[model samples]
Target: MRQQERLGLILDRLAKHGTVSVLDLTTELSASPASIRRDLKALEDQQLLKRTHGGAVAAEVIYELPMRYRTGRHQEEKNRIAQAAARLVTDSVHSVGLGGGTTTTELARALGSVGRSLKVVTNALNIAGDLSVRSAIDLVVTGGSVRPESYELVGPIADRALAGIHLDLVFLGVDGIDATGGISTHDEVEAQTDHCLMQTATRVVVLADSSKVGNRAFTRIAPIEEVAMLITDSAAGAPDLERLRAAGVEVITV
Candidate 1:
């Protein structure tokens, strides 16, 4: 596997098991022990994990992986979800809001390719960068402090920027979504900013891969009822889908 792919897998395993042994990673990643050690060291330098004698452990306060590392995970599923979401941005939808995440980033690219005139508002540095160059997109980027891990801008400044603006639809990328805990993310500040974006839109659609479905993250963005629809991969469990639908969210498995 490529280094980026290896690094992503290592962190994913650490997140699930809380610790990973060099032997296990070497076997699972099909890489040399030295290569695995190097990967561990690289993550340690980023403070993403703590290097152990023969392995690594999760950081004291585990935050979401940076966007670059997360891009390769569930990539195919994200692309499918993005395409399905793009269909919702019909000509009648003049203005749209996009939240930060890998899946939403893909949606931005899909929108650009559709060659439709749109007033796009976003708080993601990466998404803004991508859409800014598209002539058909009148891009509006909110002002706020940047969160490196997710490439999202959050805090009071962003909230103020969203205050009076209105959107026909908004696509939010969340860290987790569940029937009870509702929609959530890893950072409380980002969750608050995301909530502010939702308030500006008449319709709210959440984009999440199956892994995020049925899970609850650190901060709640809003209750499930606040969402109009959820687009996820078919890998999501049937029971979870039923629960989400029962909570008044139209769940779509792409």
Candidate 2:
């Protein structure tokens, strides 16, 4: 196949499966890993894909932009971040708290495929739906008021549930993350719920795309130091990254 046609096929696979392992790509493409790596590198250079430790993912899935805006942006970045964050989980982690948002939803989806013995606590109805049918995983949907726009279960009920539970890790997604504001959300109730979620969890990981850096939304959830890690795409600029590091947050860039 022509190089252009081959690269197109790789991207199509990435779009279809959220993520692709290099070994799988090697088999499917019927090409040398070296050749596939070169193809991936070329596509990454064009911003059409983002390379992970094992494979390339479509780049349009990482944005915090509204659903319509996210429709065609950063797929590879989100997959990369989701995969990176997934590696942090082990079978020993019996319980996890998942925040509301597309990225967190992606994390939930990734986890569903990998771990069979996990108890997931989440306020996102869609996230609950994604894992509900998976008999291998235990799902806990926090009872709360629903925010239809974001599909999040927020407000007092959500906050109370978080207060009563403890988790190994809280996978948090945000509308904006800024040096000044720390972690933030656009809705006050969601912000309050997020704060409670963070407080109950042993560790907090702030999952966001590069575009979210330096942007402050309407409410602050927690300070930067409270976040154990910030998993973001490579598009996050050096200065923003420096700030995150200086604040003592481990920044993982994929």
Candidate 3:
């Protein structure tokens, strides 16, 4: 990857978990240790991150990562999670709510390609943009000011739009997935609207990569038990799955 793209990816990980180790980046980005170190140095020089002995921290306390940075991360894992999530939509279900996040955006494309006459309600402008031109899917955009980083509409207006409609299912993408504490996003406004969307759906399915398994973010969307199923990648450990299973959540790993 180019230097700028690598820096954005590096910052993306820092924004997600607040810190990132050199070893992790070497594995995640398929870059050499020397290259990772050089990138970290550049980011620190730019004051975008704080360099540590073996890792880095975001320059400022970060909530959500910009879409540009996050879309390229865990590409295969996100694709698998998206496919697993789309399977939940069936002939019995006509409408669905799609929460904003890189993973759910992939699920939107999967749904669209399947050519189902599905009604999809979304708060993310990116997801809307992807499906808006397609005639197969009925798309509804919740009205609210966009949170530019995630391109999600979050506010009373979005909540109001979702409050009046009930859907067959809602697929949520979260920043963190703690088996006991529940799911969460980086921003409180997004969390509020996510919770509202959850209430409007009969069943809620949460899509997350294994990286977020034990993490926590700023705002809570709902308890783990409230979700109908958890779709993730095989990188998830057995212990985490057991914990979620103990909480009565149906866990599906792809």
Best by lDDT: 1
For model 3, what is the C-alpha lDDT against the true structure? 0.88
| Superposed Cα deviation of residue 229, candidate 2 (Å) | 0.5
Worst 10 residues of 2 by lDDT: 63-72
Q: Which candidate has the top score in TM-score?
A: 1
Rank candidates by lDDT, best first: 1, 3, 2
Q: What is the lDDT of residue 213 in candidate 2?
A: 79
Task: Give the candidates in order of TM-score, highest first.
Answer: 1, 3, 2
Reference-based lDDT, residue 41, model 3: 96
Per-residue lDDT tens digits of candidate 3, residues 98-197?
A: 9989999999999999987999999999999999988999999998988987889999999999877989999999989888879987888889999999
lDDT of 2: 0.82
- Candidate 1 lDDT over 1-254, as tens digits, reads 89998999889888889999999998998999999999999999999999999999999987678888897899999999999999999979999999999999999999998788999999999999999889999999998999998999999999999999999999999989999999999899999999999999999999999999999999999999899999999999999999999999999999
The TM-score that candidate 2 achieves is 0.73
Residue pairs with backbone overlap in model 3: none
Between candidates 1 and 2, the TM-score winner = 1
In candidate 3, what residue range of length 10 has the lowest lDDT sum? 60-69
